[model samples]
Target chain A: MRYLLTIVADGMPEPEKLAVLQRECPRWVHEMDGRGVRLLGRELDPPEATTTVRVRHGETLVTDGPFAETKEFMAGLDIIECANLDDAIEVAASHPVSWYTAIEVRPFAGDLHLGEAAAAFARGDACGEPFLLVTWMGGTPATPVHDQAVADEGDGWRRDLDRRGLHVLGDALGRPDTATTVRVRDGSTLLADGPFVQGEDFIASIDVVRCQDRQEAVELAASHPVARHHAIEVRPFCNE
Target chain B: MTVKPDVRQAVDAAFRNEWGRVVATLIHRTGDWDLAEECAQEAFAEALRRWPSDGVPHRPGAWLTTVARNRAIDRLRRSERGLQLHEQIGREAMLDDITGGSTPVARAREIEDDRLRLLFTCCHPALSLECRVALTLRSVAGLSTAEIARAFLVPEATMAKRLTRSKAKITAAGIPFRVPPAHVLPERIDGVLAVLYLTFNEGYSATSGAELIRTRLCDEAIRLARALHELMADEPEVTGALALMLLHHSRRHARVGPDGELVTLEEQDRDRWDCAEIEEGQGLVEEALHESRVGPYQLQAAIAACHAGAAAIHDTDWAEIAGLYALLEDQCPSPVVRLNRAVAVAMGGDIDAGLAMVEALTSDPRLERYYLLEATRADLLRRSGALGRAQAAYARAIPLAPTDVERRFLERRLAEVRATGADESGPRPS
Candidate 1:
């Protein structure tokens, strides 16, 4: 995971804090370099030079300064890719500039080209590429197609995924013969049984398919339906 | 061919300058203090063996650290224990994406944290004060247990047990390795300064060595004091301790002879004294005094300043020294302080009063085994024209003395009393 450490150094005399950084940054950079870790660092101009723009309803709106007004302003940042949040935090916490400035560490969003809605789903896949897994869940219809029970069938699907270089993230048994769902709109609410909204068949459990994109995810989800009329919902989870 | 003395001196200098840095950097890379120290030592041994043939490397500290790191990694891959440690570290290494990012200063500082943590761990309160002092001298100051024991006038076995008990207590209590917070810094400073002072005193007047002074111990104590000052300059007591040490150490060059015999304070050539150290010590003392908070060290510095300020023995302000000793006695109240006060009193021409005070200390239990008490008493007796009694007192002191230098000084005094043949009962003329 990549962390963006936004250095916020407000209220400190600019020159004094800058001098500290000047003396400390070279040492810090050399230490990290010795460890074979390279980081991207940038110093931003003053807050007065900052501008924000947004296009909404086919109109462009420009603001005079940053997106938010706060006492601690972002003066600079370093992009560090580390093993986990812990490692990222360790690096950021030890930065020489951290003594005077606050380091706001946020994990970099993956799939930068994707819009917010799509990115949320795609980002998890992007982050979890190394450890992605595919499997199926839920009980089969009451037919004598195979001797294995629904739970056993799920285990079989997991074994098959494992054979294909995929691993099971998690699995759970569906609730015994009952399920509940709820929907809310405006100030009103609705509740139903049989998997909500009088669906043709109940979704006893969910199959979280690990794939690289929506097409692969849809394809994986298609092969796991318990009944002919049943439907599956595809969602994403991150391993990073 | 034998290695040139200059080459040996150069290598020794390199080791003194870079030992800590090399150990620190290696510890960062290796993540083990004991292993890092061993690895650094191995690298130095290799340098000693090869530098004579291949010549010394430029940037020797960096070269040594890099060589040690690589050797540690190679050794780790070769041994089962090393393999296990490597596996544990390798998991983290595999996931580390921000490589080559930290600076040498940061790495050195990180390694120094280990040393600081070792100091605190060695000084944990579960151990007795003796154990804490011994272990701190051994682990933090890097002195041997034998050296520490000699400094404290204890048997080597006793010191070894003290160190073992300290380490056991630390293990039992599981003291976390860290620098103490500001709240506990005073206590930590107290422990560190006590060890430094003891180490310096041992060097100033060695216990059993043929030589009167151990310059190695003196240099090590000075280095440790400097390190403490660097680490905690804001603490007034640290500055006071440094000032006290510097003032006393400024007289080192004038304290001995070419034949390695001790020189009495009055006979020491004032011109041979270190002027730079005297000036720096004065500056430190002034700064510490400005804080206006009096402590034992500040009192000692004041006393030392009295001596350093004098151009000759006659010009020494013994009265001011006596006053500072009195203040120090109130602040610390040790028998040693009172003994020092008597010396000042004698120098100020109250010889009879000083003799009375030294006589009274004979009954003090804390000083019963102390040779200095008898030695001081003999000086008073010699001054009062009691030659027979003074010679006998000197004889009593010789057996109790720990060092050859002290024994030699006592022998000389005894010979002086024998040669004088003055009236044994009456006070002598000044």
Candidate 2:
């Protein structure tokens, strides 16, 4: 089991103690690495460098501070793979920071990477290769005929990109009203007749584009006729 | 056929010992939790029905596993999901050997690993603490959701929903069902031990436990701990946990009065403590300490051993216990540990110092609502001949007690303090 060990400081350490911990931190990492428990680790910038973002009322809201209201803030983090929960706890307990700060050992939620989704759709083992999931966020609600014409044009463009190994998959979702949302709460499953989140604008379509970098993805995405008028978003597809 | 008494006994024992193994191995083959559980349940039912006539199998665990696997395969063969048929038939080739009634050596070794996988996955930190406890009992300990709900004091429906939601998360999120690779085993030990300890605590402290099922949780936890010990004997913390539980469990009979009220340790009957359990716990703790493995549980077991080894309250080695608690306080740093260390320090002949420590701990908001803090302070005060302050502190503590037994314990102390201070009828105006 892979656990993310988050090291948070209750308050600043004494300068002398900080100096010792700074020296000891590398030795801790090195020992863990030798034991094959520590996979990766990084020291985070202080909370002053934090930027929090949220999308409320269809507008992106950005703030310049940590997201949570706690005096204990994340100081650093290490990804350590333990055999089980007890091993994770022991690792956190032995950490040098544990003497002065708290190490919150949390296991990552099970691997839900895009590879599984690709397998579900029988995406022809294309998951191992790099691909970006580009989607249409929201724009003017076009009639079915107009959408069909655009989709047909997109098919031709997709086939052209496929010849160059840049296109992997593409699809248009049904109208937002056709979406159903499910939530289990209070020992009952509640079914609501709409998308999980209601909005005047909704995701209308998505496509997988193979690319090496975001710059190339953006350049490739900009070539589609839909990007000229409608809002198109390009995101990095998770790679195995 | 009705099950004969002896046959029923054997079946029950098999169910307790082999349910986790059967379900774990079946789930490994089937990749379906509900199917594995259902088939395991059916396999037990089959044992109850057939064992009396069939004279019980030579190896009931292997027989049950073979039965459960066959049932799972039958269900899959009947299903229309062809995509998984090739993958889910992992045990189809081994069933013939298992059915022949002679266990293969390689397959026998896999049983322990399979159970550890199930336990680790159930107690995964990604789940909420309550979810982890609930899942561990249901999946690894083989408790029914209804039984678990009643033990946890929640409605059966709520418990069912919790189990369903957790299982769905496990399936949807692709939580792998395998033991973590060997090197980080030390790192993962505490979480597994914590769930077992919490399970034991839930049963141990239920003073007015109104249900037989609720009180059985202590036995269930110890059984699981014993099972864990058999699997991970090398882990000191695991051994420490088992030792600590046994030491505390050895004193259960002496912990309550005849009227079912809580009895202070000093007032308890030492002769009533089980000697065999004490010996076992002491042996385990000694072995762990000899190995130089001093985790929190081991430290606690060592302290418990001190109390168990004392023939009388006065004979208890208070200084040694105080030292152990100090080390625990430094290592695991909790207000409860500090409170315990204060009591130990006072018992070790420093009443004033203990009182000062308890008094300073009062400003800590965490201890404000804790009744033991005031109780300990009052006890120290009473011993120091400060009757008025002792009486006042006892009165302050009585209402803060969580259970009726503790409340009455405090009230008795208050009355005793009042009897000593005849000059003042009330609390001496705080």
Q: What lDDT score is found at residue B153 in candidate 1?
A: 66
DockQ of every predicted complex: 0.01, 0.06
State the lDDT at B266 in candidate 1.
85
Sort candidate 2 into its docking category.
incorrect
lDDT: worst 10-residue window of model 2 chain A: A109-118
lDDT per residue, candidate 2, A4-95, as tens digits? 55576766789987998879887888899899888655565566544443333344444455444467755665667676544565666667
lDDT of 1 by residue, A1-240 (tens): 444455656655688767977888878767765664434444555655443333333333444554335566556545565654334444655666666544554443231111332233323332323211212223343343342354455556655754654432323222212221222233222222212213233223423334556455444444442322223333333223
Q: Scored by CA lDDT, what does every candidate get? A: 0.61, 0.72
Tens digits of per-residue lDDT, candidate 1, B121-202, equal 5554434456666766665555556776766668889887766655543432223355666755676677667877876776
Task: List where candidate 1 sits over 4 angstroms from the true fold.
Answer: A1-240, B1-10, B24-31, B46-59, B82-87, B90-99, B111-115, B118-173, B207-213, B257-261, B384-392, B421-430
TM for chain B in all models? 0.78, 0.94
Report the lDDT tens digits of candidate 2 across residue range B22-47: 88887676667888899999999999
Worst 10 residues of 1 chain B by lDDT: B91-100
Model 2, residue A144: displacement in angstroms? 24
